[model samples]
Target: MLMFASSRVGSVSAGRISNWIGHRYTIVVASTIFLLGSVLMGYAHAYAVLMAGRCIAGVGVDFSLMIAPVYSPKISSPSSRGFLTSLPELCISFGILLGYISNYLFGKLSLKLGWRLMLGIATVPSLALALGVHRMPESPRWLVMQGRL
Candidate 1:
């Protein structure tokens, strides 16, 4: 529930963030935040810290969700826009599937490490995204809007 609420708030504010920083950077930022949350959750010794990590991760999720739909269209050619726009949803489904599988596999470990492994594993992907996003082109539309082009 806390995650849900935080995501809603993040979704509401993501447009402003995207406008200010551009979609590419927004994704990088979101991924970084997600990474932080994952690390926090993985190492958390207290309930409050765990919930806080969850909320932070929720915000990152919402930011990615909000930006991807808008960003995809801007980056795609008209002919490919429909297909590209669907990729985010598909990727999300894939991630969820992976998460379930990992949870099951990790659950076999000792209780102290099982959940931590499950949560901490997310940081790998988040770190990848944060590092890789810089190689991608910024949205042309966003660039134009920002008067950078």
Candidate 2:
């Protein structure tokens, strides 16, 4: 619940910040925050700490969700932009399905370790996203907005 609330707020603010800076940097920031949140949740010693981590992760999730569609179309060729823009939504659905599968697999382990692993696993992809985006060109629309084009 708290996570969802924070995500809503974060998405709105992230849009404004993305416009000021650029989508690439914004996504990097989002991934970093998500990584931190995942780590925090995995190591949480109390309910409060877990909730705090969830809230942070929520914001990160929303930021990525809000920006990916905008960023993909801006960088893709017109003929492919429709497919590229839709990828985010498709990926999100797949991610949720994966999460459920992960939970089922992890549930067989000891409670303490299983849940931690489930939460921490998210950091792997977030780290990859943070690193991978660095090599990609910035959205052309953002470059034009910055008067670089």
Give all TM-scores, in the order shown. Answer: 0.94, 0.95
lDDT tens digits by residue: candidate 1, 1-149: 77788889879988999999999999998898889899999999999999999999988888888987888888889999999999989998999999999999999999999999999999998899899888888999888897888
Question: Candidate 1: which stretches are off by over 4 Å?
Answer: none
lDDT of 2 by residue, 1-149 (tens): 66778889778988898988899999998999899889999999999999988888888888898888889998889999889988999998999999999999999999989999999889998999999999988978789999998
Off by over 4 Å in 2: none
The residue pairs that clash in candidate 1, if any, are none
Backbone clashes in candidate 1 total: 0
Clashing pairs in 2: none
Give candidate 2's error at residue 113 in angstroms.
Answer: 0.2
Error of 1 at 8 (Å): 1.8
Worst lDDT run of 10 residues, candidate 1, spans 1-10
lDDT of 1 at 117: 98
